[model samples]
Target chain A: MADEPRKIAFICSKGNLDMAYPALIMGWAALGNGVDVTIFFTFWGLDLINKARVDHLEIPPVANTSMKMSMMGIPGNLGIPNIMGVLPGMTAFATALMKKKMNELGVPPVREYIQMLADAGAKLYACKMTVDMMGLKKEDFLDGVQDIVTASDFIDMTEGAQIIFI
Target chain B: MPTRTYAGKTVEVNEEGFMLNPADWTKEIAVEIAKEEGIETLTEAHWKVIDFCRQAGLASGKAPTLRTITTGAGVPTKELFTLFPKGPAKKVARIAGLGKPEGCV
Candidate 1:
């Protein structure tokens, strides 16, 4: 009889197209390490799992790069358009770079990573406020999103869990 | 206090212990300062601009132009936009430690 795993949660609050990776990476990492992980997608962070938005998800170098730089010293105002992320070759290049980095570091792709966490019994929740603001219905998100929740519900559920805001 | 060459500028660690002076600094300078402040292990792309900002300063009195920095760093101009959301190159270059390029306020 092994002890139960400790739980962790990633609160994805960044709705920016480029800021989506941290939450996914952290959640996936927790799962890989055998932690019981949960992701609470709130506000713009819900865009990553949004069905309509997911297909169009592009990692615009301009905005994405600026966001990363912001963590270093760059201001958010200097970022470029997320639309530039859609440039066919551009998107591929960015994705390749990120994927390569992740692979080298033994991380999984976003889709597979999320699935792995889910399979390990990690929960994923979408904020009800985001769903409403985006004019989305419960059915609009991916299949694995466990349930819709208010922030309070999420906070309660995440009690005793190490939480990260991405 | 830790010290590092940011965009070729010797940015001294501030009282707050952040690497660069936060008073209107560019993203590039900010990153280097962050590194000096112990945010080591920067991603390659970040290294790219920091390197470029340094190289450009070495070559000329001013920071490289946007085109030059982008070309030098081998990063797309669009990507540079993300690193520096400010309207022009000088602002970012300044923060990067180039001390503001020409034609910048």
Candidate 2:
């Protein structure tokens, strides 16, 4: 147990409501185990750090084969049909259902999770190329973001650390 | 399933040194365990967190996670890191004579 503390770096490339949690949950767990955690948000993943979108992330059911009715405690193994998912309010409905389940399980929302991770000292970085391409400034991100760094810089920073791309 | 002496009282502990039976814990045992964890002194702050963990663990049937500790015990996350160092959730569980916290944050 006295050996060097392990380090883990998570590359977040997706920004859906469901996609945002894997890194946050895993990073929090790693920090609890005394592992150093670093997260890099690139492309759509940058929306997780965008203050405007962080709290509004939605889970569209169109391509989500796992969005089954059983998740809502319905008595069937039926998945939400892609045709039904294309309705005007389907995305909102699905997002709300997921949020309800997460709340029932005592899971923190994405914004709060980011705050918790930052307070616990996990390093958060935004991908610079994405930031520039999206015309986003540092102020567009949440306070937890440490900096906007290039992908090469991220590699150099996480040298010898276990990397997980999600 | 190993027995060890803490403050001269025999208690069962796991391989990771977490007390197997929380009923066998006492303030003296906590002190000795804290020493082994390199915490020479169990400050008032430490005891507050420990007391919360024990009660919460009993109610939940599992050790409290770091988020539970901070929100339920009224200790901030930064302060918990400072108080228990390295791994606060794991260390606090071991010293409080509770099982390790589940890994799903």
Candidate 3:
């Protein structure tokens, strides 16, 4: 076989900003390594590519506290308990802190990041099953998504590729 | 590091290099790289920071500034450190796969 880097596939299932970020991160990592990367957003993970709802993603309480602590630069073992995420103003506090930190670090907001990823040739696909289940129309998704397909189709395409289910 | 069989072949990877024997790079390595840089893992929020950096790197072939990353990550610019105490721009950039950045080595 030629020395070409193998193709990679990412299957994402959740939709919150918390879950959405990982798939995108991993996808870009593969691309960075020069691997041919394709991301298949399934179930709620498809929310990230949804134009109307993409901007509305919020962290669930179950997923917020850890996110809060992590944003504070705390280690996992040292992070705040998940229950504490329900405390008044905690999410806001965490959001504000993270925004400030991002500013200091020079990271861009979501739309720009999505645009950037698209520009880099990251192939994005939506799960047809999820789209039908959600009753979403084709225009409901963002511009970067390449196409929609079944799980079987995704599997077929990912044969021989590094497959990650996020 | 973790190993799995794909198409009757095994690929090895670690934080450092990609190899045939499942090179040892793993989440632990990514976390270690983050921690050594003094970047505390605040929460999923901070991950969004890293996520944004990845998108920027993937989209632009260049690591983005704090403002640009937050914008891309869909969070306000003021709230980044809640997830990355070492600062969003630098820490997330490191985690996003651009280590030491330009001119820092």
Can you tell me which runs of candidate 2 are displaced by over 4 Å? none
Please rank every candidate by DockQ, starting with the best.
Answer: 2, 3, 1
TM-score, predicted candidate 3 vs. hidden true structure = 0.55
The lowest-lDDT stretch of 10 consecutive residues in candidate 2 chain A is: A1-10
TM-score to native of every candidate shown: 0.46, 0.96, 0.55
| Poorly placed runs, candidate 3 (over 4 Å) | A61-84, A87-89, B1-105
Over A1-166, each residue of candidate 1 has an lDDT whose tens digit, in order, gives 2565677889888755457777775554454334677899888777767777664555547445443434324666555456765566865566555556655655444555455445445689999888888788879877778889998999899888888888
DockQ-derived CAPRI band for the predicted complex in model 1: incorrect
User: What would the per-residue lDDT of candidate 2 be over residues B31-90, giving only the tens digit for each residue?
Assistant: 999999889999999999999999998898789999889989999988998898877778
lDDT of 3 by residue, A1-166 (tens): 6865578778878876556666666555444444677889889887788888787666555554345355576655555667777788766666566556654754444555565456556778899998999998778888878788888988888878888888
Q: What's the iRMSD of model 2? A: 1.0
Say which candidate scores most in lDDT.
Answer: 2
Q: Tens digits of per-residue lDDT for model 2 on A1-166?
A: 5587899999999999999999999999988878899999999999999999999999999988988999878978999899999999999999999999898788999999999999888999999999999999999999999999999999999997999999
Q: What lDDT is obtained when candidate 3 is compared to the true structure?
A: 0.61
List chain B TM-scores, each candidate: 0.53, 0.96, 0.57
What is the per-residue lDDT of model 1 for residues B1-105, given as tens digits with 9 covering 90 to 100?
666566776655544333344333456566655455344545666567767776677577666655456556787644654444323354445445555444211
